[model samples]
Target: MTGLLTDVPVDIDRDAARRAAAEELSDPKYRDARPNFLQQIGQWLGEQLEKLLDGLSSAVPGGIFGLLLVLVLLIVLVVVIRLRTGKIARAAKAERAVFGATRKSADDYRRAAAEAVSAGRYDDAVRDRFRAVVRALEERALLDVRSGRTADEAAAEAGVLLPDVATELRQGARLFDDVHYGGRDGTEAAYRALTELDERCRRARPVAMAGS
Candidate 1:
């Protein structure tokens, strides 16, 4: 009975039918229903993660725990790579931006810097400390909180507000750029100097502008 249906002849224009189907699919509703680029990327990563887990499931001894350990290690490795490699800036005329995706309060930055110092990661400490200084200036209303503001820009602007600490602000900006963009190592001495600069900026009140 099924073979009889195959034997039936129908005048079907395959090209016209294909074109009709394509026209229907080109509708805005169909296009809107499709996954976006970011969504597609997320789905791809999820599928790859599942595949990796399946391969590890056979060789891993502790069942779920072993698989979870592998997942955790992979996450850590990726994070370490991003943190270490993301700091180096390509050759550009403008200095790199000071703040990153994660923004913190001034005190929070101080706490993070102290932790970095305890871990002997002076580079991290210096970066955090310099951020604290800039954030503190913003909090004090000496500088406005502008997105994508570079270190030199912050220093130059803040220097205008606090005349006494003007020289230190420029120096601090250069130090931050050196360690963060120049791919140079940060030292405890540098961190201390940044801390001193922060203190000076805090102590020195913003001077009144001319004709104000």
Candidate 2:
């Protein structure tokens, strides 16, 4: 039995194989056996997130439950930012002198409207052109200029002096109020309507003067 076992010649290097596997597991260069760069980054981020959550939990009342509150606050912040961006953009475009704030010349408003048209800001174009119409009537002495005079009032006052343009003035006022207060979207066609009315107001002979 001893002679047959010796002739069998078993060739096994278990110690060397074990050493190679241990080196591979410990070596940073052996990415397959060790944590890769992405895995390392994930571990670091996890540690930072844990530390942040711990700090937040200490700052607010309650323990880990505060983490849920923080998450809810983050979501609310995002929603508020989105809403402000959208509403402010709309308000900026719809703002005008008729809102009891700004005042400018007819030509100045006309130029601003033209610029708005060029920039594809149809809402601003509509607002600016409608302001131009009201200012044109004020400049022509057909309508009185006042700080709190609304679009409807301006149309009514101007219509008294220039009955020929009463229809156009009322239409322009409706467009302004629709976009500014009624939350209607301004369109290129609406802007053109105001522009045409402004041109008519420029040439209109007041009822008082037409009779003379």
Best by TM-score: 1
* Cα lDDT listed for each candidate: 0.87, 0.83
lDDT of 1 by residue, 68-178 (tens): 898899999988876665653222323477886667999999999999999999999999999999999889888888877889999999888787888999999999999
Candidate 1: worst 10 consecutive residues by lDDT? 86-95
Candidate 2 lDDT, 1-212, residue by residue in tens: 99998899676699987987898777766656777799999999999999988898888888778778878999999988876678765564445337446678989999999999999988888888998888877777777667767788889899888888898899999999898767788899999999899988898898788868
Instruction: Give per-model TM-scores.
Output: 0.54, 0.53
Distance (Å) between predicted and true CA of 69, model 1?
Answer: 63
Model 1 scores a TM of 0.54
